[model samples]
Target: MEVEIISEESIKPSSPTPHHLRTYNLSLLDYLVGYPYVPIVFYYPNHNDNDNNIFQALQRSLVLKKSLSETLTQFYPLAGTLKGDSIECNDVGANYVLVLVHGRLDGFLHKPDLGLINRFLPLEPSFDQSSVGSRVTNVKVNIFKCGGIAVGLCVSHKILDGAALYTFLKGWANMASKSEEVTYPKIISPLVFPAESLRLRDIFQVSYQTVLKEAALKVAASRNGVQQPTRVEVVSALLWKCTIAASKEAYGIQKTTWLNHSLNLRKKLPTKTSKDLIGNMMRVSSAVCKDNDETTLHSLVNKVHDSIVKVNDEFVNEAQGDEWYVAMHKLLQQMGEIGSVGPTEYYIFTSWCKMGFNDIDFGWGKPSWVSGLIGKGFKGFFNLVTLMDTKCGEGVEAWVTLDEEELKILQCNPELLAYASVDPSPLSNDHVI
Candidate 1:
């Protein structure tokens, strides 16, 4: 199916921002993000067919547009320009695009083509032209021939994270569906991770961009034992094992790989800090492993879970000091030192399981699937984005990145294939006509 861009416009805030809120300060945590624009897609299944269907669809679009403007008023910094270390909230507006597809959304949903998804997105999510250097966001409303819709949004990592994106999106949907009032987000990243002492750009330095061999791994949620394995616990354990196995087999050497998993700190923050406070509120906890035995699954899961559990309020609060920056800089130095030795690699795991993606109702309906633009960077791609099936409440989806050879080896693993199939979407089916 071919996707066509029908129209494009700017969606500005419905009201002018107060002069007091004109300049949005960038936090030290925001500076460390390095401006990677994360692209996410939401597929809403709509099969309405009636005389008023077309008119109703147009009405929904108009409603979404209006609510978006109102929602922008709450997140006014998004509609502004990034200048130096701050966002100039001058109401420059965000890009809004309307797209059309040649076929029904059923086929697309049944078999999602990631390459084709770029057509639905408003802009490319890349780090070259950083969001700080260009636009903060680009949103697209895709209307399929089947009357279904796909909402594509690309958010800059410089000012926002997954939590921020979810908050903004859910707020927009609430307004569109229930005409609810939008709450002003409590932006306090600077207070938590003050930029006064730790200048991320100045302290952190990388001499060479090392291209080490990497692999993506996955595991489904399990319920065999007394305790059902959470998505992050299961996925992290399996992926960590797979990374070790793939690295050793690919290079024919024994090496240790560092496994760093991100844990959200909103819940861990103090009540006064507030969960509603926006910005990148995530901390990374890491573990190193050289063992290749698959029998250690339970131990690895326990390790990852313990690492995540250890990120309590005290841990998050203490991490805001200079020691944290020194630790990160040393970690990078260690990574570089390790990479220079052999086929060893560093893998970062981010699990969006139990993310309440299915709860984001946008009047039409909840999206059948929500996906992140991960692994698009093929060269040395080392991160894993794990998603959950909100309806089933137990399924896990992992998009892993490995070189062609390593991927072929991973595909042959009978152990992994026994429980779950490898990228078995409808796109790979022969029945598609």
Candidate 2:
């Protein structure tokens, strides 16, 4: 799978950002996440008439580039540079690269090499504070030989999260397709959760992946006398269980493990304008298993559920009040104590499920597949798992990255294998969008 860089340019906003909106303040959550970026690619199969495929591809490329320019005007922050804890909205523009893949989309999707997929992204997802250059977003357009296209984006976590990324993409698609519906990005996250001065520590975040089929998910969800577990809940519990086992095997003893699930704060927050509020409006819910505790699926499920429940309306409201810094301090303090007691591991879980990544249709059709990377070739993250919806929209795909030894043991786990298909092809779903 060779990719030729056809062209490179910066896609600036179609219009200039007003002088009043020049400096976009970073929320406390945004500052806390440090300098990572979201790396995702959306694969769209070529559906134009074969006779006009060549011409169609050219025209489609024009539409995408043009629409992206217009979309950036609305998402002005994306076209700016990251300055300290804020975004210098000088309309610097996002780095847009046009690449031509020397292979067909199907060929790549057939095997879908995780390592090779990073080639489609313009920048690596992991970065330290000093490494976070001015650019807030990077876009790469990969045109396959078959006239198919894969749009990959690496947006700074300092400005966007999974939900915000979806909003940005949908807006771009709406412009490209010339759809009647319009997307208005409400940059109210900063106002809602203002940035604060607090001591921050870097927490490593990264991933490796596995796919859990619908049938297996069903069994896993209900296997433990637990009545109705959500897909995310069951999958998180299962993976946590596997990680615990792998750790015990590797270390010859049980180690207390902690699971931190990222919870979207949009709905939980009491803000009336949160529906369209963008940025990293998310927080992690902590669930732990002591070495002596029962680590059954049922127990894990309950723990996962309970941990998530703690991040409800009340908790969010409290965090947003005058004691916000105090709340943050306590949260970080708890995280700092991860391995203090003894041998322990902490895994971070974030779900892109139900975020409508598959439904982002630029014009031709919804993407046949959507993919992302945790932190490839980057050491800032480990023991991270990101869950996304499969193309069929029925199964969950879990991308996890763990230690090499632990990963080897996890790959051979019979229980996990029974439920997950390991690294399967994206076309296995056989459905687009």
Candidate 3:
């Protein structure tokens, strides 16, 4: 799909400020670092209709404002190590926040495009390697010739998670709509810091034997020695089935869900609890699969639901964690007793990209489109999925990636084919939302 930029604005600028040393809670650090900076892509399909005017309206609604350098402040306090020796400053503020108004577009354009999207993914920011502040530089607005608009948000994971960013965007939209004054978002930073008594070693335990054994056993059990797909593969299959079913049921055509998912290495360890953590500790993992058969939306959703649920089983989590930790530990030991070993497999997938962006509205209304790019780093599997509120109907929209072989299998299933043809209205309330 081709994108046209009707207008653009920067919410922050790239700059440094006097350092401010502030200790962050451990729980906040865990949540921040445990989550990856997965880009959110929102697509508003069929931009030609009156419904599509939301995009244009947003452009007119939002009041663009620039802040003083001192106004640039870090929302999440940095970890002590990252804040070492200097008071970190949040002098980085965007020049302006673009308000996008309008919401009519084909849903397909919002789906992930592995080829182009991967190139724009941000580099993982480091606490020690650089200053602790917003790393994101710009935002792009592209209007497609196909009557779709795609809004690309490039934000530093260090500055915000999916939830925070969405809140900001939604607030912006509400303001533009003249609904309410922008409300200050609740800062959950303090909640994620590490407990005073817990040391890094205690909180980030890295043991491999336990995780590996569990993974082996779970693989054996998934299909009675049929060789279970990797975590990426399982989620890819589930999403592909779910989206295809939803599309078929809503549009009467067998389609596919081709998107990516993000993973966080810090949280995947058997010892880690996602409750609270800081920093942008994450990686991207993706898989793609498609189905061509007719299928009810419920059936497709069930398939995706089941696949995701299965991979999170305790045995699966332990096995995946143990195997990953052991392998990394060995690699690190050989590298000369490294002080720290970052988890190689950052959890299996990211739901924030899929679920986090939908609620963002900057006064003009919900975004016509929201999406993110794949970041640079270790290479393996990556997927980015987003939960979209469809204009055609109501229900969650899932995008995923899969290989050709898997895609073929998904398309040929008769059960999936039938499931794709059902209506989504009756089943809309059944979804978790």
Score each candidate by Cα lDDT: 0.65, 0.82, 0.36
Provide the lDDT at 139 for model 3: 43
Candidate 3, residue 377: how far the Cα is off, in Å: 13
Candidate with maximal lDDT? 2
Clashing pairs in 2: 205-381, 207-400, 207-401, 208-399, 208-400, 208-401, 209-399, 209-400
CA displacement after TM-score superposition, residue 57 of candidate 2 (Å): 2.3
TM-score of each model, in listed order: 0.85, 0.94, 0.46
Give the CA lDDT, 0 to 100, for residue 26 in model 1: 80
Cα error, residue 279 of model 1, in Å, equals 0.4
Model 1 lowest lDDT segment of ten: 204-213
Worst 10 residues of 3 by lDDT: 202-211
Q: Tens digits of per-residue lDDT for model 1 on 4-104?
A: 77779988999999999998888877766643566778887676765664456567778888988988898888887767788888887888998777787
Give the Å error, residue 356, model 2: 0.3
For residue 322, give model 3's deviation from the true position in Å. 19
Against the true structure, candidate 2 reaches a TM-score of 0.94
- Which one wins by TM-score: 1 or 3? 1
Indicate which candidate wins on TM-score: 2
In candidate 3, stretches whose alpha carbon ends up further than 4 angstroms from where it belongs are 1-10, 13-36, 44-88, 95-134, 143-149, 195-359, 368-393, 420-433
Instruction: Kindly list the per-residue Cα lDDT of model 2 for residues 115-220, writing each as its tens digit.
Output: 8778888876655533534688898988887888888888888889889998999899999999999999899788777765764645746556677755555465
